[model samples]
Target: MDFLNYAFMQRALVSALLVGITAPAVGIYLVQRRQALMGDGIGHVAMTGVGLGFLLSTSPVWMATAVAVLGSVLMELIRWYGKTRGDIALAMLFYGGMAGGVMLINLAGGSNANLSSYLFGSLSTVSQPEMTAICVLAAFVLLVTLGLRRQLFAVSQDEEFARVTGLPVRALNLLTAVTAAVTVTVAMRVVGLLLVSALMVVPVAAAQQLSRSFTATFAIAVAIGVTVTVSGTITSYYQYVPPGATIVLLTIGAFLVLTALATPLARRRARAAAAARPAGDPAECSIPATRGATDEVGV
Candidate 1:
């Protein structure tokens, strides 16, 4: 309660809430497209932006957003043209981005301790400007994710089918990638880069255990994301744990609990379905072999 007296804590809570909302909003599409790890890759690239920001003495959030967006677009292009070997190219990009960040930050005279704050999140250090940036970025993510849900859903579910249906599949894919990149930046302050993907992915996975449709999954995931983020923030404040790690652990806990609950619920549904059937004796019938046609008689 005393923590709320501080402005930083207030900002951290707000940032957590926004991160919770936007991360899953964009991530559900990635999950649907079977690209759940895209957030992690984007996070890796964002580190370069953070290092660049330190080197240039500018805002890390915006720089991370720009770099992450570029990396996501490149990844999408690789997916488009790199074919079966795209994974190799992506691997290079991921490691290269990380290495570059480490080098650039060192060049900027920033120590690993400084980098670690961004890597694992230091919620109490969130500034007013960072909060403003987070809010704006989160708004953009929500606009893209919620405003274009159907088109994105269509593309994510089946690209070829979406293309045939007259949707601009490439454009939508680029937008989704860009949106996810933005989400990575939005969450960077709350969960940090290393764990942002967990926040983006785990909530949606947890929601899926209880939902049968995309709309339900989206709603439930967002709800769960908000819940865990807020809860984790408060817990971290009291327990002196890292907010990012706390939020991610809570999300994983939610997933495990939901999975356990869903198992029995699924079995119950199966049993109910089986019990709903009308019982009757099996009808007896036999078909004559080779002589069937000739032996057939009019009733």
Candidate 2:
């Protein structure tokens, strides 16, 4: 109730909600594909975009979005051409982006920018224009993600099989990379560059650990992402801490809890399932371990 009284807090809450929803939705794909930390690489690349924006005296959010999206596409193009290890590509992008951003910021004489705010988010720093950008950008991310769900799922589940089945695997990868870039930038608003990957990865990781079904995993991941983000934002509003770091801590905590309970949860589920089955009817009572995972992880 007290939080609702303040305009900034309201804005922060709205921004948190929007980012919370979209970031982890994209994360579900990344996690299933074992590319959960891809956001970290893209976040680094986005800083160059931020630096470029300052140099051009334009809106940093849009500039960062454009650059990050381009960087993501370039990454896909690299994969298509280089056939190098994904980790190697991300490693190069990570270092290059950091160096480029530093050089550009120095070149533009924009050192006055509060770099910490971008590295670790500050809810207080969100302006009306930035909020509007977040809204529009998040909407675009969600729409595209939802629209391309089938192709994205097929590619993530198994590009080789998808290609064999006549799906445009390369084109789908490019589209996914672009969408993931948008999501990384959106998450950057709520969690900042350093921790945005956590927001994208942790919730999905937790959900996957706990649920065998991709549907359940997706649903639970969204719930955890939204709940943790909103709670962290509210707490930060009262505590005067950085909202991004606080939200990240919440995500980390959730991930740890889920991890700790995963084995026990699996055992319990197994027991319950066993009890539900007739002693002589193993065929009727057995649940396939790969049921929902087949589509998500290509199991």
Candidate 3:
């Protein structure tokens, strides 16, 4: 209880909660669409922006946010350009962004700027203002995700169908990309650029294994994300491990357990349903009758 009185702890908790909610909310769609690696690319871009901020003596958050958004737009543009060759484009963007970030960091003489904080994460550095900013951003993200849920769902499930249905597929894709950028930027505070993408992906992956519906999957993912954040933060505080690594490990562990437990049950249920169907329904009987008629006609 005494630990809760510390301002740093409080801020860390608030930031974690905000990040836990928003990251997984956006991540569910990303995971379904096979764009999980996109977050990692954007996070690296945000890291480059952080270096830029240091070079300019400005707020790292602002710079990182702007860079991440731009990176997202760039990713969407590349995807559009590649069209049928999107995977190659995404790979190019990821490696390109990573190289750019490393170069910028080295050029800025930020070698002593505790870059590791943005790599593995450090909860001790979370401040009050950052927490407030994270809360506001989280709220905005939540509203946007909920407001555009239908379009996002359509695009995630079948982008071609979404295009056919006149859903502004391009615009929606850009929006989702921008959302991923912001999510990565904000998550950097908690998990750092290197590991923030994991926070966006692992929880949703774990929940997907256990959940039967999209909504249920999202709810469970958020729950798992929050639990991992809180538990990891606390353990890291006590054990002196990196919070980001701890959180990521916890998420992975949960995912493995969920996958192992759910696979057998899902298969069993499917087998049972298959067995329960009537063996000689009208449709099945008609198939043989039709075949018999064809055979007689051959005579």
TM-score of 2: 0.88
- Residue 194 error for model 1, in Å? 0.5
**In model 1, how large is the Cα lDDT of residue 140?**
94
**Per-residue alpha-carbon lDDT of model 2 for 1-299, expressed as tens digits?**
78798888888898899878888888888887888787888899998887888789888788889989989888877767767586587688887986787778778886545566677777767889988999998898888777887778888998889999999888878777888888877777678877888888889888878888777887888899999989999898778787898998888899888889898988999999889988877565566777574467543
What number of backbone clashes does candidate 3 have, counting pairs of residues 3 or more apart or in separate chains?
0
RMSD of 1: 5.0
Least accurate 10 contiguous residues by lDDT in model 3? 281-290
lDDT of 1 by residue, 154-256 (tens): 9999999999999999999999999999999999888889999998899999999999899999999999999999999999999999889999999999999
Error of 3 at 218 (Å): 1.1
Total backbone clashes of candidate 1, pairs 3 or more residues apart or in separate chains = 0
lDDT of each: 0.93, 0.83, 0.82
Q: What is the lDDT of residue 181 in candidate 3?
A: 85
* Candidate 3 lDDT (Cα, 0 to 1): 0.82
Highest lDDT: which candidate? 1
Model 1 spans with C-alpha error above 4 angstroms: 277-299
Clashing residue pairs found in predicted model 2: none
